[model samples]
Target: MLFDLHEAAANRVSTTQRRNTTTGASAASAMASSLTASRANGLGGLDTAFTSTEDLNCKENLEQDLGDDNSNDLLLSCPHFRNEIGGEYERNVSFSRASAGSPGGSECRLAEPALSTYRTNASISVLEVPKEQQRTQSRPRQYSIEHVDLGARYYQDYFVGKEHASYFGVDEKLGPVAVSIKREKLEDHKDHGPQYQYRIIFRTHELITLRGSILEDATPTAMKHGTGRGLPLKDALEYVIPELNIHCLRLALNTPKVTEQLLKLDEQGLSRKHKVGILYCRAGQSSEEEMYNNEEAGPAFEEFLSLLGEKVCLRGFTKYAAQLDVKTDSTGTHSLYTTYQDYEIMFHVSTLLPYTPNNRQQLLRKRHIGNDIVTIIFQEPGALPFTPKNIRSHFQHVFIIVRAHNPCTDNVCYRQLLSGQTLPCPHCVPEHVPSHCSSHWRNDLLMWLLPH
Candidate 1:
């Protein structure tokens, strides 16, 4: 429900600008009209891989109107459009053709196909048009690597090349966070007998990389681990990225589908279940609120954060964390806590409250949000032994839960602290406690954004 069109437009993604392969509406329309008629026949051995409503309709329509005769001419024109080492896709391709020539002597033409020409199902019939017959239709299609729908295979190839996406006429900024794909290793599946494992690295951070194996078939190990629907490496990259991008688009448009999908991913074991300190600032938060559930829907939380400005801030939880009112009485831990490097330690959530002497007119405690807690089990499996030094290493990640002996009755006392005046407690402590402040935080959309 959160993924409706309206919300998607609202969360518009305006990344760094780059050249895009703009499509003409007329060409797309013509292509779609041609394909839909063939849908009945093309249904055999065809995989309807394009899931979105708009793409399916356009592609299907184009497939129908494709004339068997012109189909060969289309392929002969854009030999480079082939899906295989040979001219497979080009042979069956359908798109508007335009004239093109080689650098010095000969001629080369390619089709600048529109999404309307985007077809599905790999095996398509190709009728060879004679060289002389193809001469009249000599207008070659313009060649360009398409950005949005290059398919996962080409995308990986492009990534490995480090060529700007202009090689595909796509916005370079919109490309994957990872810059290149290293060599891939294939291991024989226990049952299926072959699968590829790849190591991918990001452009900005070489040290940071993702390594995962793509399974050819569900083995006993795979079924137990739950990749039943796991796609191949290229396909996984191809599939998950586009889906996430769509989720992003929908988010900008104002849909909460991204949130829903993230939760679902965790539930399906596609993503890790740990909160990683990134959480949604939920609805109905007040001084009395506690027990934060990251998966729960909180529409108002977005509104609150949006109003605060799109900027983010990240700060260590240590000093401010000491201000919360956390519980140690319970042996139970919140399921949200998962071991993250350096942040893993047996620790109780630290909360804070301002203590005021009877004589101090200023309040000692201020409730910025609520006194929520983040408790760590400290004894999870394979965890390092807890030490004060080791625990200190994770202090930066601890979420602060500030409570108070007495809530500030008015802004008069709070304003004094914000104004740079030391409103000291009657006990001689400073009234204004420094809360967390940072230029960027966990909620930043580019890196990774969670609700809070």
Candidate 2:
């Protein structure tokens, strides 16, 4: 079969050369005749007989040399023959190869000419591959729950419940103050890190009053009332506490003045000087526009504040409703204030700074943020990841980083939520102090505060 194919291919090539020579000779003869014609008359008697005779001789020679049995093989083996034969022969050849149940098998066995011709001449159309099939890459699997280190199960596991509250000591004014600690798992923090809502309760029975009962009877009663005139007992008793180290907690409890100041601040509210700074890092165009127009951060920023502020029961409430108090100005220097458990927190937002035409650093903004003891850094999605080294502040000992997670339905988020894994790439901070780190799905945001 191979020998016959080769012989047929050679004959077809010779026939093509002869046909070209004959056509050239016919063109030469026609040109000679037209040139020799009379100047008065155009070459109306141009001879096409030579071309017709050469074509007929070429076809007869091809038929005689290449029989019907080898004609198909010659067409298949020679690309020149296939081109001359027309697209119909190419389509039939492709169909035969495809029907053989192995499209690649014919390609492997064919010579270079046959393969090249098959590719160039084949009219086979293919539908585009679906997007799902094109996507071969997948995200890495998240860490398993067993690999996560959730802190000590709960805060209660650290010490006995209210039973051993006497170990802390008695308050001079409140008298025999009892301390109780309770831990609550923050819904958002469950997947990100070890962040829990901790509450410290201080109870004293020395101030409670009883009707027509002895002082001893009142002494044995539950410590519900307070003798202090300023803040109510119930209000002062249970205080929502941040994630603090054991040493810090010990220092606060041992020092009577610190405890007193904490209670007073909780009652009277924090002063303007004692405010949490709101710094903007890599704020995208959308957030910058919002800030320029309304002197307020974008939805991601508002969502972050809602986590710390009072939760209101309302449908489709604005970001400001029952949340942060905004003091807007024409100069873009707006002030944000919010109360957490009656404790005032004034936020110095960076975006609210006076517009500086050429100042990219915004020194004025940094100065305010730098002086603040605690600062919250709001970062927009797709922006550069924020790091503590980006800012130089002597007094800013604590940094609360809030990152917006756009398109929260990503596989990484789902896998992390399922496996209870920490962030894939956690931000690095120098002089690292472990604090509560959490992810809020409400606005698709991740937040973590580090205190040095």
Query: Candidates' TM-scores?
Result: 0.19, 0.27
Error of 1 at 351 (Å): 11
Give lDDT for model 1: 0.24
Q: On a 0 to 1 TM-score scale, where does candidate 2 land against the true structure? A: 0.27
Model 2 bad stretches (over 4 Å): 1-274, 283-333, 407-452
Candidate 1 stretches greater than 4 Å from native: 1-176, 189-195, 199-352, 357-363, 367-452
For candidate 1, the per-residue lDDT at 16 reads 21
Query: lDDT scores for all predictions?
Result: 0.24, 0.33
Q: Candidate 2 lDDT, tens digit per residue, 1-452?
A: 00122233344456555653322112222323333442213345544443445344444433221111111211111101111111111112233333323232321121212322232211212222334445332211221111111121212233233221212344433333334443333344445443333334332332211011012112223542232232222222222211111221222243455445434422331132246666554444322222223333566555545554443322332443212233333324345555432234555666555555566556556555556655665555544433232344435544444445542323211101100011212222211121222433321222122111
